[model samples]
Structures are given as C-alpha cells and as structure tokens.
Target: MSVCDPSALARSLLAWYDRAGRALPWRKKGNERPDPYHVWLSEVMLQQTTVAAVTPYFLRFIERWPTIAQLATAPTDDVMHAWAGLGYYARARNLHACAKMVAQWRGGQFPDDEEALRKLPGVGDYTAAAITAIAFGKRAVVVDGNVERVMARLFAVTEPLPAAKGRLKALAAHLTPDMRPGDYAQAVMDLGATICSPRNPACGICPWMNECQGRRQGIEAQLPAKLAKPERPTRHGIAYWTARKDGAVLIRRRPPQGLLGGMMEIPSTPWRDDTPWDMAELAAHQPVAAQWRPLPGLVRHTFTHFHLELRLVAGKASANATPLGLWVALDKLSDHALPSVMVKVVKHALAKAY
Candidate 1:
C-alpha cells in the first residue's frame, strides 16, 4: 500500500474543514455536541439521497417530532405519510423502528460506539460510524461514496470500484486521526463534492492538490473508475383503478414485505418482465371485480432495479361493489402514504377524466 503520515494528513484536512466545511442543519458549532436524534435522522435520510433533497425532510421531521421519544410514539402511518415523496420507503420504516427501539431501550440516547449503533435498524457500518464520530465525537472511520472517491484519487488507485473498495477503505481508515476525526471526514466529503468532483475536478484549488497522486499522474478525474452495470430491463404490469360513484378511489395497502411495504398503492398485478398481461391473466389479479375498460395511456415509473410500465384499467364501482380495499376520496389521496409511483398512477387516471 502507499504511504503518508496519518497525523499530517488529518491536520491539513481538519485545518481546511474548520474554515470551509458545510454548515449543515444537523451540524453543530465549536465545542458543542449535536443532538444525537438529528445526527441519526440526517444520516439515515442522506444515504443514497442528496443533501438538498434531505434538508427539507429533515427540517419537517425535527419540527414534527423534535425528540426521539416523540418520534417513537408517533404512529407509523403518520411517519410514512411525511416520508411519502422521499424514495426508499424501507428507510422510513426502519427509521421509525430504530427510533422506537432506542427510545424504549437506551432512554433515547444513541450509543457512542460503532458496534452498538449498527445494532439499530437501518444503521449499517457507514451510518454507525457517522453517528459515532459526528454525533459523539468518537474516532471512527466513515467511508461513503464521496470519501471513496477522495481516497481513490488521493492515492491514485487504478482499480475499479467494488473490487477497489477494500483498499480505499483501508487508506481512509489509516488516515483517520484521533484529533477532530469527524471534521476530517466531512472535509474529505466536501473536497470531493466541490473540488474533486467526478468530472472537471478543480485540482488547482483543492487543499490536497499537491498531495494528490492522481493529479500528479494527470488522471485526477478518472482515478476512481467504476465497473459498468447491466442495463435495467422494463417490467410490465396493470393497475386496476376503481372509483366509487361518490368519487372515492380504491387504495390498497401493500403487504408488509417486499417493495413498497406497508404503504398504500393502487391495486396492481405483480410486475413481470416476460410479457404484458392479457385480459384472462389480468382478471385473476384484479383487486375487486367490476366491469373494466382500458384507460387511455400507460403509467411509467423507473425504480432502482427496473423500469415499470403500468397499463391503467379503469372501472366504475357501485355502492354495493366489493369492499376489499379502503375507499379513499380522490382529493384526499395525499393524506395517505402513497409511493411516488402510485401517485403517478393517480395523476394518470385523473388526466384521463375517468
């Protein structure tokens, strides 16, 4: 492995961070410890999500609950509703579960070590390390995508990612100094987000420009190359949109497992990649049988793994129709915990004037 003085590197990083680090909402000023609740919530929300997207959600959550105890006591449905637009419904579920456990077991206090923190639901290694170092001032190595890129570039690592993650993590941990470790970690993140970006890195302005091996080798932007992923295949399904005579729509709660767990969604068949469901196949998967007709257009939403193409089948249900799902009024659909894809389905139905 390459060599550098850990202490000296951390000193430079902490120095730069003191003046230039982002003043995020969950962060605290000098000598003051941030509330562990804020740290845990923000860290969970920020995973595979952007800072801008998480900021408003964080603010709303803190304003609503303000404390771990309050969040624990809050209804899961309410929490899910607040997290409706935020993708990754599972994180919201796990966040609520973790809050309840922490409130009941530890008296609303997060553990100061990485191991204990990881025991909580939704808190993986990176999140545990972040809460430990950032919230509790403990020295733990925190490696996210930003830090991975920074380490790969600083050491001029030529290996592709996933395969290169172990070496990159070791390099990051080796440089993690005891003094102001949290600030040092954030500093690296800031450097990567702003200066050492994936494209057109401002090498001349980076604080570690001179120390960066990748820059010296004239491949700063390409140091951390990633393996190409396979193209996401498109899956087809049909959503049955049945509206009552009083303008109420049928919304069903997805089963408490798999994708969109515990969230409300329009009734749909299992998404399959093989072929579009025909009338005979679609009849077997209907939420409740009514005289059905095809809607005007398709409702499309891309998920993390595959692109979903949902054909809308509309029906008018009488008062005596089968009461299989909740009859939610169209205007009040926002009150329920509808995933973004379901919301798109609702909008498509309304635009069709059905």
Candidate 2:
C-alpha cells in the first residue's frame, strides 16, 4: 500500500528487468547518464506510434540535427519536411518550438524536473515523466500505453482501460524503483512490448510471469479490455488536379492548424459527410466557372478521426492559376511539405496526366 514497501509483484518485476533488459541506443550503460535531448525526442516520436515505427524517424532526425542546439536552430520548413511521413505534424511543430525554447531560454539544457519540462510546448504528463526520469535521473513514474497494458495484465485488471487506467498508474508508481529510474522505465516498456504483448505474449520468458495476476488467472491475453470503438464515419470531397499544358501541377499549403496542417496538397473542394455534390454541385461551390473533368477513381484516406473519400478531378489551366494553389513543376514535387495522402494523390495524377 505504501511506496517504501513495494508489493511482492513489484519486486519480482524489477529484479527480472535488472538482468533481461535490452540495450537500446538512447539508453545509458550501467552508471552513465542519458542525453536529455535524445530521451525527449524519442519519447515525443513514440507517442501513438510503435517503437518499430519510431526507430527510423529517430535515427533520421538525430542524423540530420545531431543535437538539441542544432534542432533548435534548424528552419521550420526543414523540420516539417523531414517529418513529412510521421503522421502527426503538430508534434513536429511543437518539437521545433520547444527545441528553440530550450536552446535559447534554458541555455541549451532541458529542465531538470517535471514542472519545467511540462512547461515546454507538447510535453505532457507522459513526456515530462519520461524526460525527467531518463534525462535527469529523477524518480518519476512514466505511464504510457505499454506501461498501462503491463500493469493492467499484471494485476488482473478487468475494469477496461481509460476507467482502469487510473488504478493501473497508481500500481505502476508503487512499482517504480528509485535506483536506475531511467533503466526501470525502459525495462517496463520493453517488458510490455516484447513479453507482455497485446497478442500472443511470451509469458514464459517474462520476468513477472510467476507473480503476474493475469497469468495466474490464465487471462493474460484479455486483462485490459475496453469498449469497442464506433465505426469511423466516412466523408466525401473532390480534389482538383489542375495542370498546365506543360507537366506542372497545382498545389496549395494547408492552414497552420488542424489535420495535416502546414503540408502542401493539390487543391480540393470542402470535405463533408453528406454525399459530395456531383460535378454540378461542385460548380456551385467554386467562385469561377472553371472547366473540370473527373478522374476515373476516388482516392481514399483514413485519418485518426475520420475516413475520407476524395474524388479526383483533372483539369487544365493557363499559367494563370485559380485562387488556391500555384502550378508546381512535376519533377521537383519532392521538395514540397506534402502529407503522405497528398503525395499519393499527386503521384496518381502525374502517372495518368504525363
């Protein structure tokens, strides 16, 4: 019940972690300290993404910038461009802003504690805890989805996550050791990722296999249940593939906020849930009586919040572009900050047009 007297379960888990932990690049050896910048960047990139998915991004980012100071001074366009396929563009924006703040305001050092770390843009509870523990060797309990699943299964927690999440966090806090806080955090994450997996867990090799409540109860695979998500709603829109007589294509920069913010894309009519107006209905929405021709297919994309069906329309324009976008040279399209979906749309258009 108290922090000093950790449960038998907690002791067992940490002991196993002491010997069986994996050696990751960002991790410090034995008594060495970890880099705050590396910890912070890795944590941010890992959000809503798997370790496998984030590894390459982490390598690419560090290769390009190498240090927090370099990242701080890098241009926003370059940062956004490097982060093109990373899905969450907002994180990229916040990472750029926070890097500059730390470099200029904090003397190129990440704050040593949770409060200062949390004050930075995009650093929330999980991020702050991770940075504090890993970067500064502070004793902070880091609870991410991996930790949540690990704790939930260990305690036979059946309340279904989001509801069970609070108690699971409390349990994890009790288990977190003061010594090797950074290693301990990574250990638990590794345990969850490799051993206590969501599907087909390798329980026999797990450190806590003997004490795990879910394993004891023979429900390791189903401990952390949750309400099923509603079927994602679908919407329809029209993407205009305007091209010059030459090979240039029309593209625009999205506004600096919502989904795919700050990325470039082919001009598109509004996306909506109600059936997209046919060619006639689209003309009503356009300000000018421009000529439009529908492409043979629809480009489908799924966002975290919604599913999108974009009707592709190809048209020709003079060097005089319509209000939304500029005519971009086809061969040099890679330079633009395009979302993966937009990239797909552009590639599809170019393949057919040229």
RMSD of model 1, in Å? 1.7
By lDDT, who's the top model here? 1
Against the true structure, candidate 1 reaches a TM-score of: 0.96
Per-residue lDDT over 242-288 for candidate 2, one digit per residue giving the tens place of the 0 to 100 score = 76778777778889899888878787878889587588776655422
Best by TM-score: 1
lDDT of candidate 1 over 1-354, digit per residue (tens): 224677877777777788788889998888688898999999999999988999999999999999999999999999999998888889999999999999999999888899989989999999999989888888999999999999999999999998999999999999988887677767888887888888898888777877889888988778798999889999999998898888999998988778888999999889999598886787788887787888887988998889999998888777787756899988899999998999899999898854
Residue pairs that clash (backbone atoms under 3 angstroms), model 2 = none
Off by over 4 Å in 2: 1-15, 284-289
Clash count for candidate 2 is: 0
| Candidate 1: worst-modelled 10 consecutive residues by lDDT | 1-10
TM-score of each: 0.96, 0.93
